[model samples]
Target: MNWQPAKKQNDYVQTRNKNFSPPTVNQVLQNAQKMIGPISESPRLDAQVLLAKIMKNSRTWLVAHPKSRLGAQEDVQYRRLVARRAHGEPLPYILGTWEFFGRRFQINPSVLIPRAETEHLVEEALGLLRNNRSVLKVLEVGTGSGCIAVSLLLEMRSLGVVATDISLQALRTAAQNIVNHAIGDRIDLVQTDLFSGIRGQFDLVCANLPYIPRKVLNNLQVGRWEPRLALDGGEDGFIYLRRFIAEVAKVLAPGGSVVLEIGEGQDEEVRSMIRLGFPRAPVRISKDLAGYNRVVVFET
Candidate 1:
């Protein structure tokens, strides 16, 4: 995506020194701080990640060799990435990859950048699978970037996954990730809304669907950079979520379970919807690292 800075700032220009000598790693980091410090929560770390990308090295390497010099092209690339971050573009999208569940996956504007909180949803799903040895099939709705599905297949060798998304662009991005991790044979990528074209029952159904309300999407700085199709959950922020729960009974196998990542302040309401769909199932909510209610699990 083309991410122009929301407001023009000297951060991009100020980082460029007009001298003949190459800029040292420390100097570049300082300049990046000057450009993005005000806008980023982790300015130094962002600077390091960008620089590391340019240098084809790790952040730890950059730290150890603070006096190393950047090539002319490297300096230019670093400044450009800093400008994008200052403008509110997510770092993962700028870098073209993000880490989730301890593994890295390709990412782009077409897909939502995987967040650490979503890892909790993966953890909950893994917990359920660990308890039930017979569970073999899994389905991930709104499988943007295929982070959840790919991670699950990697963790559980015997399981097969059928991941679905309404957007073809999203399906393409997820397809790249499935191929990248060499798990394409085990995961099927389908372009369909929720469970519309899905055929068989799944032992587990998981999703990190759009849950941000339309109105709320406007005010969010980070949200503006992400694809609306991946964030808009309708007026009440549960439109897509409600639909998923309603259709769970059709695809979920006997003794199967459903796990979903939800917005904050939405635990009880989502649990209620899951209960309405599966009246006799056990519905439970799980919290993220910050202790906020973030995942809802439905087990029959």
Candidate 2:
């Protein structure tokens, strides 16, 4: 797999620089931008955010107080984190928190970092279920950090969610997020591969399962940094998704829906599979901010 390549870590790590003194916010950001430019798409923003995180201040604060110097310990910590980022570690994993659907979620390498594209899946679910008068029951196939399930519960007051993940470590990570959002009572975190131990009908099913095809995953930095179990979707990237489609009819209530975040060009393939599972269910497609074919939906 192609891990994000960076200039050597030793170049960035001074490894904590015991003799190094604190530097002004602007100075440190300038240095970090050069250090992180290789692996990050947004070097300056990444530098600012990481430094702001270390400083316990906002990026705007950093801008306004560009001359403000970091403490000795904070400087060391900032460089240490910069080294980790320079080595291809994702920013969210380094920071331990990521914003999804306007809320911050705790994240680790154990779980897939929540992506903005998946918010379309969440919105698709809410758009279909929000007006329903009854309490909507939701089944999230791979809960990851529980961001999707948690986002749903927060937006709609009448949702009861049952979220499952194959990895116990991933589930533990999701559990922390569930607690962080104070939605534990409303959601059940289960450790199961797909729908293995799951039962009962649901009003809606939403998932951002691993759909990165093995070949594509092989060349992607995400596959290197994110959990393999949460990124690999077998040879064609449809292993888990196909399995979910096959079993969905058995668990979905009449008129219920399935919302999924699919790969950029997998819309037709996913639609074809959904056709086999729910021949008559109407399918809807929604694009992400980048206009990629992203969230796909089908209703039973």
Per-residue error for 174 in candidate 1, Å, reads 0.9
TM-score of each: 0.92, 0.92
Sequence-dependent TM-score of model 2:
0.92
Residues 1-300 of candidate 2: C-alpha lDDT, one tens digit per residue = 112233555543543777655578888888888889989899999999999898999999999999888886687678778879888899999999999999999999999888888888888888988769898899999999989999999999889999999899999988998888888889998898788878899989888889889999999988888999999999999998899889888778888888999998999999999888788989988899999999998878
Clashes of each: 0, 0
Where in model 2 is the C-alpha error above 4 Å?
1-21
Q: Where's the lowest-lDDT run of ten residues in candidate 1?
A: 1-10
Candidates in order: C-alpha RMSD to true structure = 4.1, 4.4
Q: Cα miss at 69, model 2 (Å)? A: 1.9
Worst 10 residues of 2 by lDDT: 1-10
For model 1 the local lDDT of residue 230 reads 93
Which ranges of candidate 1 are over 4 A from the true structure?
1-19
